[model samples]
Target: MKITTPRWALEAAGAIGAEMAGTIAATGVRVVGDTALLSAVPEAVEKVPAAPRIAPEVAAQALYGALAAVASAPVRHSAPAKARTVHQTSSKELVRVLGHRCLKRLRRR
Candidate 1:
C-alpha cells in the first residue's frame, strides 16, 4: 500500500521551504550541501545594510534622564469622590421580580 501526501500539503511545504531559502539568502548566509567546501560572497555581505550600534553608556544616560524627568513632574490631585445612591434588593425580592417577568413572557407566548 502506497501512502501519498495531499497536493496542497506538498505545495505549502514547497512555499515555506522557498521562503526560508530566500530569508537565508537575504541574511548573506550560504548553505552548502557539501561540508568539505564553503565560500562567502562579499557582494552578498555588502548588499545587507548594518544597523547603527548604540553605546551602552549613552543608552543608560538617556534612560536615567527620562526617569528623572518623569519623577520631577508635578503630581495632579483629583477631586473628591461624590456619594453614590444605591438601591439594595433582597434575594427573595429579586426572585419574585424575575418570576413575575417569566410568567408575563410565558402568558404572551
Candidate 2:
C-alpha cells in the first residue's frame, strides 16, 4: 500500500494493461485485483465512450477505499455442529445400545 511514488499518482507498479481493463467508468463500485475490470465498469457508464479522461487523485482514493472495503469484509464460515462425532464403543456397548439380535446379525458376516 505504501508505494515509493507520491500518493497523488496511485499507479500500481505491477499493474499492466490494467488501464484497458477499465473499459467503463464504474461509480459506487468495488472489485478485487484479479477481476477488477468487472466492477470498474461504472454503473450506467458508456462501455466505449470518447477519449479517456484522467482520474483525479480524489477519485482514485475513493476507488481504493471502496476496493479495500470489499476485500476486507468479514468472511462467513460454517458454524460448528454439536454431537458431530460418532459414538464409538465396545461391541458390548454397541449391542446394548443397538439390540443383541442386530449385533448377532452383524457378527455372522
Candidate 3:
C-alpha cells in the first residue's frame, strides 16, 4: 500500500516541523545522549502518518537537530528592502482596536 502524510499533520508541523520530521525519517538511527541510542524511535515514528502521534523522544531529536543547525548558520546583518519597508510602516496598525461592536458582528457569523 502507498503511504502519504496527511494535511493536518503537515499543517501542525509547519515549515520547520516538516523539515525536521523529514530529517528524522532520513536519519534512521541517531545517537541522542552519551549512552542513549535512538535507533528504533525514528522507524517507529515513520510507521505512523500523524506528526502529533510521534514519540516525544523522536520529536525532541528532530526539533533539536533543526534548531541547532539554524543556530550555527551564519547571520546576515542587513535586512532586505522589503523587510525594512515593512518594519518602518506607519504605526496606525498598532493603535487600531476592534471594539465590542466589531466583535459582535463577527460573532453573528
Candidate 4:
C-alpha cells in the first residue's frame, strides 16, 4: 500500500534545503512509500572543519591557568533551602490544558 506525506513536513524540508546551500541536491523533500528522504551531495561532507591543534607550551599554559582559577574560586558548603513548594503534574493536565485552549479557539470561531 502507498502512503502520502504531510505537506507541512515537506514545506519545512524545502525551507531547510534553501538554507543548506550546496549540501542539498534537490529543492524539496522526496517521499517514497512511507519514508521521507533528503538527498545530500558528497562534496558537502568534505566541507567540514578539520581537528584543531595547539603548541605544547600553549597547551601547558592553558591547563595551568585553568587549574589556578579553579583553585582560587571559593566553594559553597551546601545549597540554599527551597523557597517555594513544588507541585507535580502529569500528561493528563497537559491534555486538559490543550483541550481547553482548543475548545476556546473553536468557541471563538
**For every model shown, what is its TM-score relative to the native structure?**
0.29, 0.20, 0.26, 0.24
Superposition error at 44 for model 3 (Å): 34
What CA root-mean-square deviation does each model show from the true structure? Answer: 24.6, 25.8, 20.3, 22.3
Residues 1-109 of candidate 3: C-alpha lDDT, one tens digit per residue: 4575675554554655556656776788674543212221222235544456778999977865554454444433355546666455434421222233343454588
Which prediction has the highest TM-score against the true structure?
A: 1
> If the candidates were sorted by their TM-score against the true structure, best first, what order would they fall in?
1, 3, 4, 2
Clashes of 3: 0
Q: Candidate 2, residues 63-109: lDDT per residue as tens digits?
A: 55554444444332233335232343344433343444443454587
**lDDT of each candidate versus the true structure:** 0.51, 0.43, 0.48, 0.48
Could you give the candidate ranking by lDDT, starting with the highest?
1, 3, 4, 2
Q: Write the per-residue lDDT of candidate 4 for residues 1-91, one digit (tens) a residue.
A: 2354565666667566555643443556653442223422222122355454878889977855554454444433233326322233344
Clashes of each: 0, 2, 0, 0
Q: Report the error of model 2 at residue 108, Å.
A: 64
Q: How well does candidate 3 match the true structure in TM-score terms?
A: 0.26
Clashing pairs in 1: none
